[model samples]
Target: MTADTDATDAGAAATDVTEPGATPTATDTTVTPATSAHPGPDAAAPAARSGRRRRVGGGLAVVPLLAFVALAFGIPALAMLDGAFTVKDPVTGASSYGVANVTASVQGAYLTALIGSVKLSAFSAAIGVVCGLLLAQAVVTSRSRVLREAVLTASGVLANFGGVPLAFAFVATLGNSGFLTRRLDLTDKGWSLYSFSGLTLAYLYFLIPLMVLTITPALEGLRTQWREAARNNGATNAQYWRHVALPVLAPSLLGGFVLLFGSAFAAYATAAAMVGSSIPLVTLQIADALAGNVLVGQENVALALSLDMVLVAGLVMAVYLPLQRRSARWLA
Candidate 1:
């Protein structure tokens, strides 16, 4: 009996001990819980919900800006559209919906004003683009931080400094019987402060600075590595500008031109104060129609002219937006 009990104990000890190159028995094997590599559908639901919530929050943040635009711009644009199409008779006090106001706006003196405004804006913007680009390049290349800050500060101030005050300042300095006019004998030299050319000069005062502000960031976006690469590739300064710099900057330059064009196009107070109706401009025509300075009952025509201006602005934006998008790739 003792021998049999000893033999049973030995067999149990042998079962518990695992031997090398031996298969494990059911009693010796441990069962571990199986785990999946990928998360189940239940686990993924919360993540999707969180992502949706973040998107909702982002959309909510833009609501205010959309509301402001709808209130400020949409309402005015709709009003202008309504007024542009509405025609009224002064004597009969009768109203009709037609394109008469729009037709009248684009004919005769109004046409002249539109053409003149376009020419003036194009000329001033072209000049401003060139001059401002050069000035911004100079500022960017300068060693003095103080000079750069001074120039930028002055530009910011001067860009916003327009309207009646700007007109008065220019008149005081460049008008007939004015300080510079008399001293320099500008009138003898066929220089009149109240002429189209003078108006262009006045526009440049603000436009150049605006161009400076607009193009400076683009100029700064030019990477030094590009210059180095160009130099290493046997490019001269002129070649570098023509091949490397100008190409990259073209979109930005065009965008700046568009901005300057719009600014010069819509300007009113300065032109009204300085040149009156001497230089035909759409803005002046609009003012004359609204105030009946030229003819009474032309209010509808004024709205039509404003609509025309808005259309022109839309065209400018159409051109500018594409250029801006293309430039953003390189600059960003």
Candidate 2:
């Protein structure tokens, strides 16, 4: 009877240890291969389908932008490229593909205009970069919030204040019978409003502000810890800037210079209104060719010039984009 009672107690203990719905302990908490692999086909298929749907939705969202770019830029670029390589036959009055226009565009008068344009762009961009950098640095170091806001607001306004209106404003202020020209008698000092020097002066009005806006953000990205570290190492102001600040700022500066150069190179309305045929800018030559002022039915020459401008601008942007990326790595 004692042995039978002991067996009954042992059977109850075993039942308790193997309880059907009991909570798992630490040792039993590990994941099994079946549980780790997947939640079964039903759960996985829905999740995969949802992910694919999201990717498709995202791609669909950008379709309009892609279409707009294709129509606006890609088609026009292709048309110009085709025109650049095409010529009209004088005897047959039929268009044929050739490189005569391209050759004409790169030699003699057209070549001179191209070289002049490059020189003007280089000069204006150099000056703009220097002045703009100084202004941006000054704005960055200022303590007054109102002053900083005011400078930035003014810069935003000035940077975009270009085109024919800019030309008109400069004319009103500095034309022979105009405000400052009359007050200061600049004409007597050999100043001409239609000269290349005059055009560069007008360009600087907008270019400096553009530089200020671009470089200000770059200046702000500079880490204060860098200056502090430099000082801790007994570096002077000049030494700090040369060794720490400038090296970091170089990419931004170079990128801004390239942007300015391209801006000056592609400028049309201001140069057209102010100087016209007086200055042999590539833009003016293009306009003349287009209007049949130079060569009628030979608009291919104009397209060739356009293609050259595009190539130059493309090169500048190519340089700028890499520099901008380098600057971002540091700034970020």
Candidate 3:
């Protein structure tokens, strides 16, 4: 056989063969892409796969998040909303869905609880925001290193130290049998740290620190140039605040009050511990209902209580709806 040796020929594959006297021919096709030095399909595969994996990974985050909310928050919320208008049949233990299930007595209790909660929360938030603003201003404008550090350190501690322990601390400091009460000999007119008024004071203790922390950032956002410009234009401190600082800080302050109100409204542990069965907070009421009273079935009452909570929270949110629509980003 006459052996043809041409590298360009389709059948001439190997110029250097391992076997002696054997030449392997290429197939009847040209291989163009497989040996491309720049980028073959395989080399690009990893990057393309990585791109796809990133998209899938990012999309997967939402799935677990939504699923978590659905399983835990959504399901329970729906159940609560349903319970608001549904009642258990005393005889068969079947739920009877009707608007009438939100009876006059339940409605009264809800309204009473809501009014009390809002009053306490509003008073607490107002006091908190005012004190926090002053404290933050003092800290931010302080020239003393020691005082600044002390303020920051105390703020951090008190901001986190709320609820039951906070309640008990007040009880020790200001209650009828408190240290100060004995020292001052005001046993007849001692501070009541367990009553509604006292609870408002306790709420202020933590909430003020929270407001200070929240609004400090906003205060720091104020430009030194603006204040200097105002001063250069011969504006008084009050005028500077009225014209510039107030305008900028008002939204944040209002938003903080909204947040603080929501917090205080839902607080249970402090309120419950301070008064136990003596005071009837909505959260405490919900807990009581969950215990399954012989008169009011557990599920039925828990549902109603949940509904009551949603309604009160909804009302508080409604109060902030205008603000929500306006400076939502700032508020958030």
Candidate 4:
């Protein structure tokens, strides 16, 4: 019996060892609970691929707008630049490249037209600044929200309200046979609608509104505390404006003026409609040059004038951008 018990014990020990080292079945080969619960590389790879796809989709969305701008604004600008230096041969009708057209554009009647545009822009912008500042200040100082909202809304609309329609409105209001003109009979007083003075007067319609839109925020930025502090320091209202307000608002005011100057300088349709060929504006001269009315085959001169206008506008922006940043520092 002792021998038999030893044999059975030995058999049990052998069975235990074999069971612990047994091969897995088909069920064990399939994913276990822990293995299924924790995903592996294949599972995470799809997530990474989806994230990449989202980024690529976002990039593709901007392509249409970029293409549009390249075709619309970029292509036109390049064409104008190329045409500016190109001179067409009168004999062969072939195009040759030279800066002679540019030189010609900068002298003679074209020069006069450029100067006129500058003077008109300067005069209009100056008047608009002063008048618009007053209007903006008045609007800001008002107690009524209705007044402020109404003024701002009107200003926004009027600021963008230039072109042939604006010209027509001014004509109906102040032309020789117009309502106000007929009522006032301003022609007897040396008033003429088809003149530079009349064009400047019409330009003020939109210019003042533009100034108001630009300057209203700056005027509002003039804190009540500053005025109160000035008054408490025994400074009069006039003194406050001269010392405190003027200095504080100078950058914004000047920036607004520069913006207005550029607006007036680039204006073509309104000036064209109002003055026609009577006044010699650079824009009008350009139209004439392009239409082959003044010296045929001088289309390059038109492009040169356009280049000059672009340069002027560029210079204005260069000055205005720095002043604008400075103004934001104070307002912020």
Top TM-score model: 1
After superposition, the stretches of candidate 1 with alpha carbons farther than 4 Å from their true spots are: 1-31
Clashing pairs in 4: none
- The TM-score, computed over Cα atoms with residue i paired to residue i, of candidate 1 is 0.92
Model 3 agreement with the true structure over 1-332: per-residue lDDT tens digits: 13444535534444333465555457433567755568878789999999999999999889988999899999888877787678667799787777554563266665566567768888898888899999999888988989978887888788778778977887787778888867887667745666777888888878888888888877877888889999999999999999988877877788778778877877888887776755556676667667754245655555666666677677767766675455444324
Q: Candidate 4's error at 256, in angstroms?
A: 1.5
What lDDT tens digits, residue by residue, belong to model 2 across residues 221-266? 9999999999999999999999989988999999889888988998
How close to the true structure is residue 323 of candidate 1, measured as C-alpha lDDT?
A: 73
**What number of clashing residue pairs does each candidate have, in the order they appear?**
0, 0, 0, 0
Which candidate would rank higher by TM-score, 2 or 4?
2
TM-score of each: 0.92, 0.88, 0.74, 0.79
**Model 4, 1-332: lDDT tens per residue?**
99999999998776555355778665446574655676789999999999999999999999999999999999989989899999888889898888988898899999999989999999999999999999999999999999999999999999999999999998998897889888998889998888888899888989999999999888888888998999999999999999989987988888888988988998999988888878889999999999999788788899999999899888877877776777677788
Cα lDDT tens digits for candidate 1, 1-332: 99999999999997799989999888888999999998999999999999999999999999999999999999999999999999887789888899999999899999999989999999999999999999999999999999999999999999998999999999999999889999999999999999888999999999999999999999999999999999999999999999988988999999999999999999999999999999999999999999999898899899999998889888988987877787788888
After superposition, the stretches of candidate 3 with alpha carbons farther than 4 Å from their true spots are: 1-57, 104-106, 292-295, 318-332
By descending lDDT, how would the candidates be arranged? 1, 2, 4, 3
Per-residue error for 188 in candidate 3, Å, reads 2.5
The candidate that achieves the highest lDDT relative to the unseen native structure: 1
Clashes of 3: 0
lDDT of each model, Cα atoms only?
0.94, 0.90, 0.75, 0.89
Higher-scoring candidate on lDDT, 3 or 4 = 4
Worst 10 residues of 4 by lDDT: 26-35
Question: Once model 1 is optimally superposed onto the true structure by TM-score, how far is the C-alpha of residue 316 displaced, in angstroms?
Answer: 2.0
